[model samples]
Target: RAFSLNYWAINLGFAISSAGAGFIAEYSYLAGFLGEALMTLVCAVLVFLKVPESRPEQAAVKTVGGKRPKDEVRLTTVLRDGRFMGVVGLSFLVSLIFQQGYVGLPVAMGADGLSSSDFGTAIAVNGVLIVVLQIPVTRFIQDRDPRRLLIISSLLAGYGFGLTAFAGSVAAYALTVCVWTLAEIVNAPTQTGIVVQLSPA
Candidate 1:
């Protein structure tokens, strides 16, 4: 959920920065880069000032001898868990797919000859879809099996990306993005919830 929130903030910043870039295009690519830099700096400042540490209060407590609470199990013991290894592998694969989308989409859009306005509109559409649908989708799935949702999300994202590979028009690309956004809606919350549930006691 925190990851989702950070992703949301960055996307929000991107939308604002992209609008700034559209206006600053009269200047140069340097102007747009500077605008993005400014936005990133602002986000960094806000996070530093406003975000609180989430570490457990118990972690700050000391024993009578002044030693902090010690781990009962060794790192090697935890590392021996098969489920932990599976989770790590799944996490790596998911992260790879997620980052690849970010890097690959712009290249695909540029190749398809999308204008600035069209690209912006498509992204805005994606944001809007998430904002409107995410809550209802969460409510609908709250009582259902999360693993099933995760599998479905993977299929949706795969199909979405496959469609994007052949997209020729702005509308077609937007449609493709919409499919992936829905997948993300399902993907993000379910994975996060699972991670929290699976954490060692």
Candidate 2:
């Protein structure tokens, strides 16, 4: 539930920012940048005012059979956990793949004669889909195996980008975005939940 809420919040922010940035950039790139900076400043102030530290009182405790253990959790111990390291590595690879939307997709679309505004509109599909579908998708997959969901996510993400190779129009690019956005809807919350599960008590 926590992870789902976090995912929803992220997508909500994305939707608003992406759409706003598109319109703002049409007027002036400098204004768009300044607006973003102002929003960041606002968010920082909100966090400082409203957000509380959530660190556990016993930072070094371990979990045994879903119960807390008294042992201290060390950075060295976390680094030594092969499973955690593997999860982290896989997450990094997934992030690299996802970043292509921001870095490579716009360039690719521009090369195909699309404008920056067009790119923004197309990419906004990602945020829109996540905002609309994240909760339902989370509920659907919440009871399923995280590993299986992640595998499906990996495949979806791969094929989502792969389909771009055949894209020649904005519609084609938007379709590709839809495919990967679904993967993100499935992958993000699951990844966060997994990390929570893997963390020490």
Candidate 3:
């Protein structure tokens, strides 16, 4: 629930800011940059005032090993955890694929003779679906097996983007966005839980 809320806020801010920046840029890029700077300053102030320091209490014992002795989470412990590192490796690969949503998607659509507006319309579906479905989907998956969820999400992300090779229209692109957005919705919060379970205290 906490991670879901965090991700929700991130996507919400992104959606609003992206739309606002587009309009602001139409008038003046300098004005858009100044506006962004002001918003960033405001965010910095809020975080300083409201977000508390989470200094996870750690014992002074400086032991180095693959095994964590009881209620202890150190850098070496996390580094040595085979399962966590494996997930990190796989996540790197997934990220490589996901990045194509930004680069490859636009290039492919442009090759298909779609305009920038058409691409924006297709990508907007991602933010919209995430905003709409994140909370409900989080509720549904909260108590489910995390390993299972991650495996499913990974496959969903792969196949969802894989289906993009066939998209020649805005609607088809939006449909692919919907599929990968589901993967993101499931993956974001669930992956956090897995990390905490396998790594954090």
Candidate 4:
């Protein structure tokens, strides 16, 4: 339930930001960037003011008592964990693939003679669908195996990007976005949960 809410909130932010960026960019790209920077600063201020530190003094004291290792050694231990390292590598690959939506997709659309706004609209479908579906999808797969979910999501993600190769129209690109967005809806929370499950703490 916590993961579901987290995923929902993430998508909600994405939806708002995607649409807002599009509208902002339509007026002035520089203003859009400035607006994003301002919003990021506001979020940082809010976190500084409202969010509590997760690391407690007790944890530091326990570490001093040899219940926990020093930071450098702890990082070494994490690096030595093959399973965790594998997960990190997989995550890196997935992130590289997913970033194509932002970097490559827009370029591809532009090459097809589409405008920035059209690219924005196509990408906005990703945020909108995830916002609408993430909670329900999270609930449905909450009890399922994270490894299986990750595998399925990875496959869907690859296939979704593959479909983009054949895309000729904005609608086709949007369809591809929908495909990968579902993969993202499944992947985001599932991956986070898996990381938590795999952590020593």
Q: Which candidate has the top score in lDDT?
A: 2
Give the Å shift of residue 188 in candidate 2.
0.6
Which segments of candidate 2 are over 4 A away from where they belong? Answer: 56-70
Backbone N/Cα/C clashes per model: 0, 1, 0, 0
Cα RMSD, model 1: 3.8
- Model 4 ranges off by over 4 Å: 59-73
Worst 10 residues of 2 by lDDT: 54-63
lDDT comparing candidate 3 with the true structure: 0.83
Q: How far in Å is the alpha carbon of 72 misplaced in model 4? A: 11
| TM-score attained by model 4 | 0.89
- Structure candidate 4, residue pairs in collision: none
TM-score for each of the candidates: 0.77, 0.89, 0.80, 0.89
Against the unseen true structure, what C-alpha lDDT does each candidate score?
Answer: 0.71, 0.87, 0.83, 0.86
Worst lDDT 10-window in candidate 3: 17-26
What's the C-alpha lDDT at position 128 in model 1? 66
lDDT of 4 by residue, 1-201 (tens): 688687788778887778677667778999988888998999999999999999756533345566654543466788888998889899999988899999989888989988777887889898899888988888899999989999999999999999988997999999999999899989989988888888755
Ranking the candidates on TM-score from highest down gives 4, 2, 3, 1
Model 2 per-residue lDDT tens digits across residues 1-201 = 778888788878887778677667778999988878998999999999999988658555457998855466778778988988899999999999999999989889988988777777889899889888998889899999999999999999999998988897889999999999999989999998998899765
